[model samples]
Structure formats: structure tokens, C-alpha cells
Target: MLIITPQELQTDRLVNQLAKTWQEHGLDLETMLKTLREVRSEYTP
Candidate 1:
């Protein structure tokens, strides 16, 4: 049994839009996540 909230649905839609834009720019989800991790690590103490 699985359930999804409205907020989760909205987030999925937003991610889909972002993914499309990233693809148009020659980027990908994996690269986005890796960049996010690297940026966060830089800010962490």
C-alpha cells in the first residue's frame, strides 16, 4: 500500500519541468545531484 500527498505531486511536476530544461541544456538528474552534493559539502564545516 502506497500513498502520495498533494505536495509530493506538485514536487514531482516541478522536477519534471526542471528535468526537461536540464536536458535541453545538456545536463541530467545524476549530474544535478552530484553538483548539489559537491556544493553542499563545500558549505559544510
Candidate 2:
């Protein structure tokens, strides 16, 4: 069995909005992923 909570739904909506905004600004998936990796590494140490 699986259940989706309200917070999860809201998070999904926010993620979709971010993706749309990124696309509107001409960001591609590869670039977004690379940026994410770089940011993660910066905070990981």
C-alpha cells in the first residue's frame, strides 16, 4: 500500500514550478544536475 501526504503533494508542486522556471530561463537537465552536484560538494566538506 502507498499513501501520499499533503506535504508531499505540495513539495511536488513546488518542484514542478522550479523545473518550469528553470526551463523558461533556458536551463537544461544536464546543466541543472551538474550545478546541483557542485553545490552539494561545496557544502559537504
Candidate 3:
């Protein structure tokens, strides 16, 4: 999985560890952190 962690991204412990792995994995972790901050702002300067 795409687990690019750090930068203070604890996101409720990664949404309770991805809600215990899976099962109707309806995601919405803050809208996937605003689409991973707009795809990391095109790779930070």
C-alpha cells in the first residue's frame, strides 16, 4: 500500500490502522488528507 508516512501524519493512528486492515473499506480520512495535500504540492519545492 501507499504508506508515505511522517510529516506529522498520524491521522487517528492511520484511521485505526486502516480500520483493522479492511472490510467495506469506505475511506474518508479527511478526504485522504485533501488528496495527500494535492499530491504533495507537486513535490515540495
Worst 10 residues of 1 by lDDT: 4-13
**How well is each residue in 1-45 modelled by candidate 1, as lDDT tens digits?**
899665557889998999899999999988989999999999999
Ranking by TM-score: 1, 2, 3
- The predictions' CA RMSDs to the true structure, in order, are 6.1, 5.9, 13.3
User: Model 3: per-residue lDDT, tens digit, 1-45?
Assistant: 788765756898886778766434665667678889999999999
| Model 1 bad stretches (over 4 Å) | 1-9
Residue pairs with backbone overlap in model 3? none
For candidate 3, give the lDDT: 0.74
Off by more than 4 A, model 3:
1-23, 29-31
For candidate 1, the per-residue lDDT at 22 reads 100
Residue 27 CA displacement from its true place in model 3, Å: 1.1
- Which model, 1 or 3, shows the larger TM-score? 1
